[model samples]
Target: MTNLLQTERLIIRSWIPERDAEQAFVIYNDPEVTHFLGKSSRVTSIESQRQRLIEGIERMHQRNNGTGSWAIVEKESTTIVGTIILKQLPDKDGLPTQDYEVGWHLRRASWGKGYATEAGQVMLNYGFSVLNLPVIYAVVKPENHASIRVTQRLGMKPIGRTNKYYGIELLLFQLDAPVKIEESSS
Candidate 1:
């Protein structure tokens, strides 16, 4: 249940509502950040967001498999810049698709910094290593070129588009578990 992970310059840790709600509100409220996220508008109140954050944490903990949204913190500043998520998405039939997804959302100020890709790589590593998944997936809005690039940097290839996610069509990208090669000796 402990899902703390580290990268060269970032610390990916579990979401604590009390500690993260304010920063999360700022990230979630930014229209530019939420534009591709499918949120209708900015979150208006910290109280409401706190409720949502509580629920989000509960859902992740419910999974009980170290899969959930975690705060993306700057190692030097100790600031919560954004979140990186690894979780399962339901299929069209409302059953588990058995597909784990990797995604990131950062504050506008934090954009253009390679944090998303940095955090994403570790999450993918954890998914494949700790979780032992066969393949991981990402669904991005077509117009969000920045995120598309992150997925590309993660070496995720576009499989296709589908409306199965959140009832809307999205560009699907996937990365398979790395195949190991063995040395042959004469």
Candidate 2:
């Protein structure tokens, strides 16, 4: 229910089951959308999708560390185009890992626009500014060029490939917060 950030054209808001479950189902189940999203196939049940939303909500509330997914909505249409996630990768035991991640999944209809780049900047800013995280990571499937482009536009550095984190091979990109330079009058 919390509105996390707002861009010129998109509103990145929290994942609320009562408000976002149905659309979340649509986004998660679309094959084209899920094509690079790992071994998971199109989710078949709205209930299951609702559960995922519930879990995301719980996770967002669990830590004041600014880790979770938010719904990306277009301001004019007020449509849920996709989601942007900023969270730490979980360890094998499902606990938070050292590497924090920033990623996005947009509707097929929403592809090719700058929405991902715009929304991603907001999330990255939140990670660095609000969360005070020194670095944030983005792990993408090797074949997912669109997302790669998005991360690049956000000024993230492509570190290397890694299978250790997400249980699958991914091209890991990282971005450190811009250092603040205080002004001093001579």
In model 1, what are the clashing residue pairs, if there are any?
none
Q: How close is candidate 1 to the true structure, as a TM-score?
A: 0.91
Candidate 2 versus truth, CA RMSD in Å, comes to: 1.6
* lDDT digits (tens) for residues 1-186 of candidate 2: 668899999999887787777888888889888888855546778988888888778877788666888899999999999999888897556677888999899988898889999999999999988988999999888898999999899999999998768566789998999997889887
Off by over 4 Å in 2: none
Regions of model 1 farther than 4 Å from truth: 1-3, 92-95, 180-186
Q: For residues 100-181, what per-residue lDDT tens digits would candidate 1 score against the true structure?
A: 8898999989998899999999999999888889899999988989999999999999998888776678999999998757
Instruction: Report how far off residue 2 is in candidate 2 (Å).
Output: 1.9
Best by TM-score: 2
The 10-residue segment with the lowest total lDDT in model 1: 89-98
